[model samples]
Target chain A: DVKVTQSSRYLVKRTGEKVFLECVQDMDHENMFWYRQDPGLGLRLIYFSYDVKMKEKGDIPEGYSVSREKKERFSLILESASTNQTSMYLCASRLAGVGELFFGEGSRLTVL
Target chain B: EDQVTQSPEALRLQEGESSSLNCSYTVSGLRGLFWYRQDPGKGPEFLFTLYSAGEEKEKERLKATLTKKESFLHITAPKPEDSATYLCAVQAGGDTGRRALTFGSGTRLQVQP
Candidate 1:
């Protein structure tokens, strides 16, 4: 089974704080994605990486950025966190051209 | 733009009851439709993938069937352990460059003992 790991399960931060969420996949998959989930809205794609040093914006990429310096590791960076940014963040990885996405446990962020 | 919608925002049933969840989608070109189970505070776990109309896939008590514009997930004799939010996602042919899926809001299921 493919394993995807998120660095944190929970975090609490104040407004204007910079936050970093990291994800790692052990299966050498070529695609990685970050999604944010809120109460009423489903998982919304924030960003995705197809290769090392490559990234692209998803539908809701505002106030978020990503880094994929290495194939197995991907990171999401929030320059300035706000109350609206507090939500559950999920990281997923998949083999190129495959239809399934293997997801990590998830990281829940709370900004006050 | 691609869109996915799930019906019955929430459902509650007895342990032995059988029920079905619906997922409707609209995309420029269909590539694949997927179902996932999401436990509270956890990321979604992939369940099944339907590539075309009339495709069906099953795992344990959960069976997923797909059509041109909709899909159905039938849960037979669900248990307390099966209580979770079921999510639906779709991959559009136009999303080859992004390699991402658009997801529905999800249906929250609770099976009472």
Candidate 2:
């Protein structure tokens, strides 16, 4: 079975502060993604990395950035946390070209 | 643009009651349709993947069927453990291929014991 681990399960940050959410996948998948889930909005992708050091912006990537320094690790960074950024963030990984995604437990961020 | 829509935002059922959840999708080219079950505060768990119309996959009491434009997840003899938010997603294939999935708003199911 594939396992995706998130560094934080819950976090609170003040407005204008920078936040970091980290994810690690044991499957060594080449594709990793960051998504924010909100009520009535479903899952909106923030950024995705197909390989180390390569990133692509998704539908909603404003105020967010990503890093893939290693194959097994992906990180999501909020340049400046805002109340609007408070939501559940999910990390997922999959094999290249495979549609099936194995997800992490998710990190709930509260920006106040 | 690739899109997915799930019907019936919420459903309540007594134990042993059966029902179906619908997922409608539109894409330039359909690669696959996926079904996932998400528990509160947890990530979505993959359930089924339908590749083409007339295809069906089953796991325990859940069965998923696919058509050209839509898919259905049928739950039979529901139990409290079966209660979760069901998510539907679509993968698009075309000249502009995408690796990320387009997810629906999801259908929240509650089974009463």
Q: Could you list the CA RMSD of all candidates, in the order they appear?
A: 1.0, 0.9
Docking level for model 1: high
For candidate 1, give the DockQ. 0.82
Distance (Å) between predicted and true CA of B14, model 1?
0.9
| lDDT of model 2, residue A106 | 100
lDDT of 1 at A4: 100
DockQ for each model: 0.82, 0.77
TM-score of 2: 0.98
> Chain B TM-score in candidate 2, rounded to 2 decimals?
0.97
* lDDT tens per residue, model 1, B15-109: 99999999999987888899999999888999999999999999999999999999999999999999999999998885456489899999999
Candidate 2, residue B1: Cα displacement in angstroms equals 0.9
By summed lDDT, the worst window of 10 consecutive residues in model 2 chain A runs over: A94-103
User: Which lDDT value does model 2 have at B93?
Assistant: 83
- Please list the residue runs of candidate 2 whose C-alpha ends up more than 4 Å from where it truly belongs after superposition: B95-97
lDDT at residue B44 of model 1 (Cα atoms)? 97
